[model samples]
Target: MTMGTAGLETQPSATTYELGDLVAQAWSGKVHVPHFQRDFRWTTKDVLRLFDSIVKGYPIGNLLLWVRRTPERSFTLGSLRIDAPAYEEAFWVVDGQQRITSLANALHPEGHLHDPFAVYYDLAERKFISQPKTREPQHVALPILFDLKRLLAWFRTEGEAVLHLFDEADRVATALRQYKVPAYLVRQDDLDVLTDIFDRMNNYGKRLNRAEIFSALYAGPEDGAEERLNLSRIADRLASRTGFGTIDTDTILASILARRGPDPARDIRNEFTSAGRRTAPEFENEDQDTAYAEGEEALVRAISFLQNEAGVPHLSLLAYRALLVVLTRFFAHFPAPEANTLRLLRRLYWRVAVSGPAVFKGSFTQVSRVLCARIRKGDEHGSVRGLMDTMAEAPRSLPTVERFRTNEAAAKIILSAWWSLRPRSLMTGEPYDAQDLSTLLGDQKTAATAAHVIFPRGLTAQQQLYAGNRIFLPTATDPVSEIPVMLMRQPIDLDDRTWDAVLASHVMNREATGLLADGDREGFLHIRQELIAGQLSDFLDRMAEWDYEDTPSLETLDFDNLDELEGGDDHSL
Candidate 1:
């Protein structure tokens, strides 16, 4: 039965079909997945959910197909190797590629060999599960059971042993054949009109990222000059070379605009569009080859500074991407800074990290523009000083123990700053290696395992549980005996001697531990905040003093051992 397009001036004919029929048509070379469609990206879980929805009778959404009168090319569907007819007219899916591909792979037994969509019916749970090849008696492979002859053979031989589960199997088989998918079939001949319809339909509720949009805009005809400007390829190459996980295309685009355009804050959507290029001549004449080269070099320099100087060796540890944008502009403007200027820049970097810049509202365009202007004028000191001053005024106040739990950026900054101290694990008396921390920092889950609460959350009041109360400890070490069970456990039932032993271990500063031992939770958090603030101040001060002649070392900052607590005022607590 034919249907009509929704919400359009000129309607196109549409149709509907049972899912089983759709899969049958796909296998027999009647329906084709178009070449322009993206690769199948649905995960195993997504596929499983689709089947579950079908069984539960939930609407799986509509499919848009172009009724091609004459096929222009040949393409494969899902992971299936079956040949689609190249010369015959067929229905080409414009929307619902994901759903159609998933249906084809799961319902057709031959489709499973080419794809990773192996699914099973859990006899006990009565749900679909994607399971690896196993001899478990309860799991009935969907492809095998969906075939009527195979299901009958299985019942004749071994079905009686689990005959009770056959009801669920029959239910699933019946649903698979009866489930109907709504479809639309358009007979449009204009390729451009079809492309526009496809894009508008896909982008209705969910918007694509700037990178994806820019990639589409910059992409050229099969053989055109704009093909070389593919933003996605450029970003991927940069990520591979620098070991920075997925350098975002928007970040790269922002750097290019900062270097070549009059205003870095121009509407990026318009800037990259055809109309934008025609209206703004700067985009046409700008040397993208040189801009990309300079941007890459500047990014390398900025990453180097973060790793070697700021103790932030991994991109994941960075609190904001805006910082990178600002740094890229700075480095691009001044490829090399004086030794003193470099020191000051380091302070500014950490300062912004610890206290997230408030000006990140508009992708940091204004802040980046101001800093670029200063750097262009050769006033490096003024640029850094002015930037820091603006950051200080950001809505976020100085970090407190409570803020640590809520603000992820603040927690990361505190953790990184504390790690800079190189505190030895109380159980082993050996310093934690920076390299180990760097590797762990690559992912948040792994990084969290690097630190454990000194006082277990269950033992402390909600207010006492903050950054100050946590201590960094390696989860595992070579000497198994070096692992501290006390730190890992709650302090609730431990005896006085055990408590004193833990306190004396000095995992944190002496003052903070003394307050904890005395059960002064308020005093402990207060003193801990001061100590963290003081360390941040002291570290930045030392960084600002660095000169090319005699570069100041981390040792000079006295972070190896907690010899001098920066804010050790007793009355403050």
Candidate 2:
């Protein structure tokens, strides 16, 4: 039935919907998820758990929606595409987006390969697994199992091994057919009422993140577009601009807030217009549009400092985002700092990263706040000195290659330092550009996409997992497995210089290659690992500048010698 907005003062109407029908409605455009809801964040494990819950008669949750006039448009839920005609009143989903999108896309026949929704049921195991590269009769695609005609056809094609499970397949199909979702259709007229409900619902137990809360409050009118000032999009732009994946919505919000004041945890609901909010002098009395623009500008400058000057190549490689937040404030205050101050600030960055969390004498949050407080307007020199003094007081811990991991801050420091040596693509022999690296990694949350530890079956489990086996090369094939093979025969095209340069890019000398050629894989790793440890140690020490004394910044020094002081022949002093 087509429900209209009625009884605005009364409670929201409730109904139960069949799972398959809800998917069909979403696909056909009768139902739509609003933009303020979080994106599809469920991993395949989450999806599998959800399906398992359903099959085991567990309750997922209720879906809350609003009934309103929706315009004709095209939208996507995961990989499923929809084209909807204008309706006087359509169901606009306010919550349960992740579950709905998961069901819609996972059960859709057109769900793309490698999507979290690509799932199958193993009839023999009676369990769900990620879709395999090769298909077997016992493995039933979820989409096909949910359809009556397809299930009938699937039975006819399979041999007697699958015939015995007909009752189980029918039972699974019936479970899906009977599974119902409790839904609420709000008929509220005022947009504030809907936002209030969303706010109240999410605030009950802090269900939503601060970024999502800010986004929901600022999301435009019901008939307008979704999430006008989405911080996640801001993060995406910064990530793309610098090839630094995932600035993170919380960090992006904090960056914008840092441009306003030192307190990132300040009330974001009144960020722009509230007189209570603290803002930088030049940024005062601005609208959200201006705040977003200028704040993004500050963030870009900070990210560029890390990428260009600080030797950190990727966002994932940065040891701490709290450090990035502090730097964002510094750059926002002094867009082009004096040369000496910039150098000192870069040194401070290296010191903090190499020292890891131990760089903070207090709690990380307290230290971050203290650092942000140091960066005030018109005091660039003082800021640098304060930051250096604060970090230097804390002890240092240089990174080691042992227990190499993608997510650990120490490992990130090691990877960034390795890239400082300019790891090149083995195929092209060209330096691995940040842009190309970002494209290859593509918003991967960890360094696993960029680094690899090869494990040939010849090695023991302990030997296979050794950090020495790790390589930081960018190639389609693993360098450890392929490099020896490539060097086995004489190169038809390239000369020794080119090949030598290629090996150097990977931090491997011919001696290492000779070990690799002799099938002594451990020996090859040992040579490369020893070289990496020395280089990383030197890079960290040089960047930290522990021995350098802090002097007045360049602009602060008196440069008014009138060109006579340095001229040897000038008699006029």
Candidate 3:
């Protein structure tokens, strides 16, 4: 393949080497990974697949290396922490980091490497399997078996029963040492060109994304005389603090750019030069130190508003990344608004979320610019008005019961908003505390305990069930079987005391519960939809005070005749 030199193009030289020799080169400071490369991302299963391929005499892949004279820095190999000293010349792996890392970690695991690829060979099954920290019988750790003396000692003590397996172990060791991987050595000095080449080569596989490339361009030393800022690590830290899960690097970069002038939604790579600094006057004159600090503070405030006011308690429930950028810019412009203004802003936030695709129909950049301009002008009313105006054009209707089951964003927003009203559990009649509900929603395992269907799915056909059919029941309430049992009995079979208990325990209004008690499938759906739509309508109205005539309202479906309802055939109670 053609390689680019200092303003010149040339062909790279090729060579072949045994696997053991490559491992030795990495251990002895003759090879290293450059700072621009991504961190090791392969899992234990991937490592096992590599070893299995090697044992089967399959061609793994070729290694692309840049031969540099007078290396600029010292480095470590994989998770082994095998420090390689700076040398006059060293080969830096550019394209085959995953393979090289897997080899180094698997071969030299005895160095107590804190790697994820801990594996062993099961002698009984004759296969490679991922092993835990603790040892098990009939299993030989790959790292320990790399050494002949250790292998012989282990066999003498542990392999006496499976003496016939000695030949298999010897074969595995031979294959690892004798396997030759093709290599290409190129001499290139331009960092930008090297990054381009790396990107192009990886396109055939799991190529690097824009965020990863941006991170590589801006990443600083992990350990140095002066602590340098790493955007990736900073995003991770923010997510941990907010319990928002892992935030994408692009979102973090956009937030930082938003603090400065210009739309953060545009291509970020254009903002940075090859040297990794702002190129335009709008950004060049801005102090990066202040921008980063303000960006972080504004993001925290935005997340707080989302959790406390908007009912979006976690990051997974956040439907759009564009929303974060808009909120970040607003908070950056207006660090703290008055109490009434803050209340208006919170209302606007939930309205936008519930409005769905309408609020984000046009260019996100334009939306961010508009909102930020109003906030900067200290026009809180205008800011809220502008956002609502955009949302007004979209068809704003309460989602159907079917939509809640299928659409994740809608379900999260609706449930979170409803949960915020302190609705009582249908089973226990106890008011749900916001903190406990938020914790349960944030965790996957506990989320199921927060809500369930009043009529068990087994009793009704698919068409009869929808989001309105579900209720938020506290975990401490009566068993789930209790409700189904009462519903299964005839109306006369349930005494007045039991009926009162059922009505009080469920969050449904009296009209909706009466339909359920009478086994009127069509009436129950109509009443439940009206009840939920009414709740949503009231919630939106309470968010802010406005005089706009185009404010969207939830349409309550009414049916004069039960047979006229759609999907009535399969919805018999």
Candidate 4:
């Protein structure tokens, strides 16, 4: 009997029975079975919960079975074997794989069922083991058996007179053979109905990908059309390699886009959308499909190169995000960046992955800006290599004065090169372009650099200090506030006049051109304020973006001892 929507009389009819009875009847071939269904995959918990429901007399659910009677319709049930006489030649199960598997294990003889050990019990620990066999390998549970000898022995001894209660089991089993499990039994001739029904059912718990639903709907023939060809290939590959039996491409795409942590195989269903009717939708457009395909392909390629070519050990979300951005840029601009570009990209990639995503986003934009500057500006004084060498350790610990110096060095080298080439400030975003670089680098050119003006731009410590000290000199307790304070405990033996020049240079390099309006001094201070504010805001945005729980403090990080591994290693996988 096809339990079509019209055939299903929704009069709130109720039936009560233990799962064991249903399994016995289904096994006996007295039920309708869907040809496309797989066998029971119920975990121990699922089994236990079924038993608990029976013990507590709770309503489990209706059993959905398909009624058929053709030898051609019989399919090899997964992890199950029928030993008893055939109850029905064509009957197969449509739903309740877990429930049926559980009941079989609880009542059948050990070693008689396909998977003899279906449930696990930890003898030493005296507790039921958890799901995912890895968590409880030492445990042993029940097995499905149909040996009449064993059943008789059990009834005579362990089962006792209580075994007579099976009359009730038979009654329930008989009823289930006729009861509907609330499914639409489709015919080979009506695939559209099956496709629609499958999509609706699948989208209920989590959203399915447009590609996936399309694949499932049109999966009947393997003759590949270009549009549907890749979908099946990808789906088949993912299912074979990953065993994500109940998921589709949409879930995978969402995971790639938003999931955190080091495990690429981690579930990302909840990351993209909430649980509701909106979870499953037919993919909206060609552009989105293209983006998803491109993104997945890019990620796959990155993992392949990092793991196989570069020998990187571990893949982290931080590194992946940065790499994604870099790849996106490459795909957009260079189309095919050089191997050297990949090497440089990898150098920074590992740094971010190990540092975690929160730190990566916080530092990436500034780092990218610094990188662009260096590439634009040639190494006139061997500063570019020196900067990369020094900044290598910045990813391990919080930013410190020394690390900041490295950043400053890179900035100086890059900015100098940029200015040397395009003398116009990228920061000011002004349209004015200068023709001569010499005019900017003329004698006493950096006498008003942003750094010189920005460092301790206010009045000297001695000027506001103790009753007798000079305005520029450090008092006994206030040495930290002196000009030498910026020297980081290093003594500068320069005369007052030279000290003034040094301060001026620092301010000139770091100061914004906007701050130069009322003379270099005020402009220097104003630029420092702008840079500091901008950096701080970017940092906060990273924290929010990563959803970091604890704010990480800035300190010097040691990249040397980070157990760093390259991209080509198997560990990268």
Clash totals for all candidate models = 1, 0, 2, 50
Per-prediction TM-score, please?
Answer: 0.68, 0.84, 0.71, 0.38
Best by lDDT: 2
lDDT of 1 by residue, 311-402 (tens): 66555556666667777767666678666556667766765665453544444556566554444435555565555555544443344445
- Candidate 3 lDDT, 18-108, residue by residue in tens: 9889887877777777666767788878888998998898988889998876444455666665555667668888778889878877887
lDDT (0 to 1) per candidate: 0.61, 0.76, 0.63, 0.36
List where candidate 2 sits over 4 angstroms from the true fold: 1-9, 111-114, 122-125, 138-140, 149-165, 203-207, 222-229, 275-282, 424-431, 454-467, 477-480, 484-530, 557-573
lDDT of candidate 4 over 1-573, digit per residue (tens): 123453222322244443445556645545432322322455556666665455444666644433333332232233445443444333334345455555554544432243432443333343333333463333333331133344345446545544544443333333323333332232232444444455555556444444444345444421233344234345345333322222234434332332121222223332223343223322223233453465455445544444433332122102233344333323322334445444444444444433443542455444432332332122212222332342454444322111122123222222222222222212121221221222222222121222221234454543222111111110122233433334322124555454434333222232343334335543444454344334423432332223222211222234554535433365757
Candidate 2, residues 1-573: lDDT per residue as tens digits? 123454359788899998988888887887887777767788999988888888888998999989888889988878777889998888888888888888888887897354799988888788888888897778888888899898888788862468888888888878876799999989876775677678768866698887787777767664546444467778877776778788778778777777778776667656655545445434667777677777888988998888888888777788888888889889988999877877888888888777755555566666567788777677888778888878757554567676677898777887888788788655556677776667767677777866876544677666665556666765554354664466444365666787687777666778887887888888877887787777777887778877778677556656666455667576656
Q: Any residue pairs clashing in model 3, and if so which?
A: 426-505, 426-506
Better of 2 and 4 by TM-score: 2
Clashes of 4: 50
Sort the candidates on lDDT, descending order.
Answer: 2, 3, 1, 4
Ranking by TM-score: 2, 3, 1, 4
Count clashing residue pairs in model 3. Answer: 2
